[model samples]
Target: MWSLWGLLLCEALLPIVVISVQVLSKVGDTVLLVAECPPGFQVREAIWRSLWPSEELLATLFRGSLETLYHSRFLGRVQLHSNLSLELGPLKTGDSGNFSVLMVDTGGQTWTQTLNLKVYGAVPKPMVQVFTAATEEAQPPNTCQIFLSCWAPNMSDITYSWRREGTINVDVELHSLFSNGQVLSVSLGLGDKDVAYTCIASNPVSWDMATVIPWESCHHESASGKASYKDVLLVVIPISLFLILAGLFGAWHHGPCSGTNYLSVPDDF
Candidate 1:
């Protein structure tokens, strides 16, 4: 009688064992693997062995079991749950590989499913650059024409515009607004005066703007001819005064000598 009861109990537990093993499955970013155990049996431990393991299994397995006896050698492993979801955080290029999930039953039965994992890395940031006209020597009036431009290293599809400093005016006179960037040129007239100007470049991904001011553009030549005339008058006035003094001295000395000779001649008569 006891033997018959034992046989009946074994039969009842068989279906449970099968159901437990069938429910083991997981979804991951890089890989998808499913593990199953018998219905009546629970997973005592889970193990994963990878041909090229990125991180140690002991460190990667947070919630699930990682026992030596239950551990299985696979490219990837995931824990079994009612709704199995494995979020392989921030995947790298090297994370791509074949993966499998191993679930060990209390009765020592193991089940595993193989999956192929493809990892995709995130895109890199775009490179930005500022372009401008050539720098020239400082002229007398310090005036020159300026050109502003912007570009990206690897990206071709971009948009650009120009902005001026301390003004509400937007510049629309661009030489060329290419698929990559834009170029703007303006005739900057400068003197000794101080002023400011700016250029702005932008795109969908990023924006870069630069400002420049040729302060010498505002200079005006103060009436230079009037200054030259005043200098000439200063030199001529001093020379005229010296000539008048010399003539007066010669006349005075000769007049005295002539008067003395006339008086002596009258005495002889």
Candidate 2:
């Protein structure tokens, strides 16, 4: 019984040098890999290597030095930090791999750790497109409702969301209402008060948003209101002036101080 337990323990402890790490990155960005060492032990040497996509030796360093000797393709893009960490960057999609580091302690014992890196491209701002049945539906409508779609060009691994007035809630999807991850439709009759729509696009590296409204149509409404006011003034002003002139003429003809005796010399002339 003890023999089986001992064999299991030896097998489990053997090749246990690997400590795996996971990370996500974008192109033209940096990724760092770290090796943890127990305190009070001086590192005599350190070596970083890539295991997946090919076994390539990437770097080696000695104590009391700052520079890391790197592979030919990795030159000028890798650096060593004080805490026994390696930084590789302005990354590329091909840089995704399993990175390992081996350390030699003061007494010359060897140990290692590994990292798994995954890379993606950065996402740009989303462009929102809206559609409606009404003519000139380009703008948001106070009378009707619409459909909206968001597009993030030249990007992958993206997700989408819809919002209104900067608030997110279950009601955002409930007003005669419904929304897909990237598309949405709503109606004004629902009394939803969602004056505007916003689309948010996201990826592992970044996220952005765009908003739309029908204010141009509202602008036309304001102009119409101003035109109506001008029309009312045009009619009312002439009518008011005519009334004033007629009143003056009637008073001159019928008032107590009429034309008969006000200027007595006019009859002699």
Candidate 3:
């Protein structure tokens, strides 16, 4: 009867539970995750696991001591802290997942919580891309509009923004609904030909920027490959000079006057 009464009393009192989240870690870095417990409830044991790639055991702790790290992949890479929190070092893309913590308190009360880990490469230098253009004849001077997009490869959840630099007073209108005007589809005047626009790509961890001048972006590739008159003249002039000098040297060395020697004149007093 006493044992039954003690079991009932134990069931009535449950340890308070706390869960933590929003842990962000970059690739090739360490991330610390804590499984917190309320006061009066001592952490007796804990088990860390994941369901992101089916069932997998990460590590375990007993009485604040590391009991085992069951997964071979995490054998040398995992550390169990005194508070039963887990520290994963040198993170990789494969480390992203939904992880769970199963904690048992001293009173035999158990608590569970899950967190999502996202690991990604640092943001790359963004590239600004131009999509369309209009000539001055088609539109009024400085009324030519172009579309621009900022791209950072392999990055997710990025926030994009666009701003113009220069005194052309160009209009940049952001798309209202979706990306909050990250992409610019606007027009600029002929007087704005030298103006540059910058695109910014950002996330919770980092940001990158790229700049573009609309008037030059379209012709950038084509103009680079074509030879100019100045280049042709530079090549032709040097070769022409070499040929002329060679002809003069040959005439001096082998011409009619080459072998002719003047008769010696007697010295007159």
Candidate 4:
């Protein structure tokens, strides 16, 4: 049977044995791994190691000193703090994996902790492009088929989602060609001119969005380089009124309305 004092001591030490920590970081960013020491425990030396994707020794730190020696792939990108914590910066995808740290206390007791790091690239600004599908001719009268594609240039590991008017989800009846929401197929009628959609591109680290109106895009494409009758009227009406006013001004200045007397008084009078 275990005594009460022994059980209490075991309970206090249980939390520090083989601890695991998780860290999240983005590409070109920095992350810190803390070496948590138990209360009243004095560390004499600390050794940090990378344990996954081919094991390698990282760095070592000594107590009471701010200097540390880094090795292998962590030469210029790593720093060890005075309290046995590690700081790594300007991170890359290759830096993701399991890391471990071992600390030997002044009494020769060892403590170990494991850290799991995950790195992700920031999601770029997405662009939504609209196209009028060739199947419009086969569709019902006064209806159009529009195809929309969303993309983030030079980015990967991203998922796409769509919303209408920036709030509501896309209708269930609409067809989505890709499971990742990269392409959307929309069928619109004449009454759906006000419909608009936004595409959101996201990754674990960041997200971006772009918006497009399928009807407006398709209409603009069909009307390219051709002026509407209403637009022509707006331009012609203004110019016609200006021309009429200019003609009246010219007649008043140069016609019989001029102040010059046509007949001269007789010299004899």
Report, for every candidate in turn, its global Cα lDDT versus the true structure. Answer: 0.42, 0.68, 0.68, 0.75
Ten consecutive residues with minimal summed lDDT in candidate 3? 260-269
TM-score leaderboard ranking: 4, 3, 2, 1
| lDDT tens digits by residue: candidate 2, 108-145 | 55567788888887788889776653435575544545
Clashes of 4: 0
Greater-lDDT candidate between 1 and 4 = 4
Q: Give per-residue CA lDDT, model 3, range 60-103, as digits (tens).
A: 66545675447545667887777777888788878888777777
Q: Residue-wise lDDT of candidate 4 within 131-237, one digit each (tens)?
A: 88764456798677888899999987888887777335546335656756898888877877887888899988889999887898767765752567568889999
lDDT of 2 at 5: 38
Which tens-of-lDDT digit does each residue in 37-58 have in candidate 1? Answer: 4457465444443433542341
Q: Tell me the TM-score of each prediction against the true structure.
A: 0.26, 0.61, 0.64, 0.66
Q: Model 3, stretches more than 4 Å misplaced?
A: 1-20, 136-138, 166-183, 190-194, 218-269
Model 3 lDDT, residue 187, Cα: 65
* Top candidate, metric TM-score: 4
Q: Which 10-residue window in model 4 sums to the lowest lDDT?
A: 1-10
Clashes of each: 26, 1, 3, 0
Clashing pairs in 3: 142-188, 142-189, 142-190
Q: Which scores better on lDDT, 1 or 3?
A: 3
Query: Which numbered prediction scores highest in lDDT against the true structure?
Result: 4
Superposed on all Cα atoms, model 1 deviates from the true structure by an RMSD in Å of: 21.3
